[model samples]
Target: MKIYDIPGFPNPLRIRIVLAEKQLASQVEFVKVDLPAAEHKQAAFLKINPTGTVPVLELDDGTRIAECTAITEYLDNLDGDPILTGKTARDKGVIHMMQKRAESELIDPVGIYFHHATAGLGDALREYKHPQWTARAEWGKLQGEKAVAGMRYFDSVLEAQPYVAGDAFSMADITVWAGLLFAHFARIDVPDDCNALRAWKERVDGRASVVNPA
Candidate 1:
């Protein structure tokens, strides 16, 4: 299998962590994509993923998979144990719910704010961002506000449970972790009062996969 991605990027890092967790790093070859150069938006890259995103997985037989969630689901299940996703119906439902929340509430907002409100990835990528929305810095600022609110919400959730979904660490936790990472990059700091979220971050940071991902 081959993974097309830029190393150290938040979305790609999520899958790399999954690979480390599942011990599948050795089984895959990673091809770096120059995100800052807008390589993903080019015609060649678009053929593999019309959405023009990085961290796409290509199976040996030529099947291509896009989106972090979908790639994670495939990698997690490949070993049969499915530790990152979930083994039970209830776990699966909760994990997916929290994963969606992590993206919608946190990561996605940070991305919007980063790309629109700031000079994201420099001039090469500027043309690809929504032309109508590019000048609307105010809207991007609002998204940054939403991301802060998301941090508070996740803090509350963490106060009541060991992980995002529940007791065990799952894909939801990875998404949340990466969301916080993206937030940091976008200069959206977690609130000082969000102790639980801060604590949870420290714990997750110590994990082997997070510290040394694929």
Candidate 2:
């Protein structure tokens, strides 16, 4: 199998952590994608993923998988002993629910704000990521506020549970962790009062996979 992504990027890091958790790092070859250079938007890369995103997974037989959730689902189940996703129906439901929340409420907003409101990735990728919209910066600022609200929402959720989905750590936790990471990069500070979220981040940061991902 081969994974295409830029290292240290938030979305890619999510899959790398999954690979580490599944102990599948050694089984895959990594192909670097030059995100800042707009390599993903080029014709060659678009053939693999029309969405033009990084962290795409290519199976040995030539099947390509895009999106972090899809890649994670494949990797987690490869050994027939899925841990990160979930083992039970209820767990799967909750994990997917929270995972969607993590993406929609937190990470997605931060990304919009980063690319539109700020000079994201410099001039090389600006034209592709940020178009000529008069109100884009204002719209991005609103999304940034939404992301902050998301942090507070997650903080409240964490105050009631050990993990995002429930007792056990799952893909939802990874999504939330990555969302927070992107939030940090976008300069969207978690509210000072979000103690539970901060504590959860500290705990997640100590995990072996997060500490040393693929």
TM-scores for the candidates: 0.98, 0.98
Q: State in Å the error of residue 24, model 2.
A: 0.5
Q: Please provide, for model 1 over 11-127, each residue's C-alpha lDDT reduced to its tens digit, 9 standing for 90 to 100.
A: 999999999999999999999999999999999999999999888999999999999999999999986899988898998998999999999999889988988898888899988
lDDT of each: 0.93, 0.93
Q: Distance from true position, residue 74, model 1, in Å?
A: 0.4
Clashing pairs in 1: none
The parts of candidate 2 lying over 4 Å away from their true place are none
1-214, model 2: which lDDT tens digit per residue? 9999999999999999999999999999999999999999999999999998888999989999999999999999998999988899988888899999999999889989998898878788887865666588988999999999999999999999999999999998999899999989989999999999999999999999999999
Which stretch of 10 consecutive residues in model 2 shows the poorest summed lDDT? 126-135
What does the lDDT read for residue 2 in candidate 2?
97
Error of 1 at 176 (Å): 0.9
In model 2, the clashing pairs are none
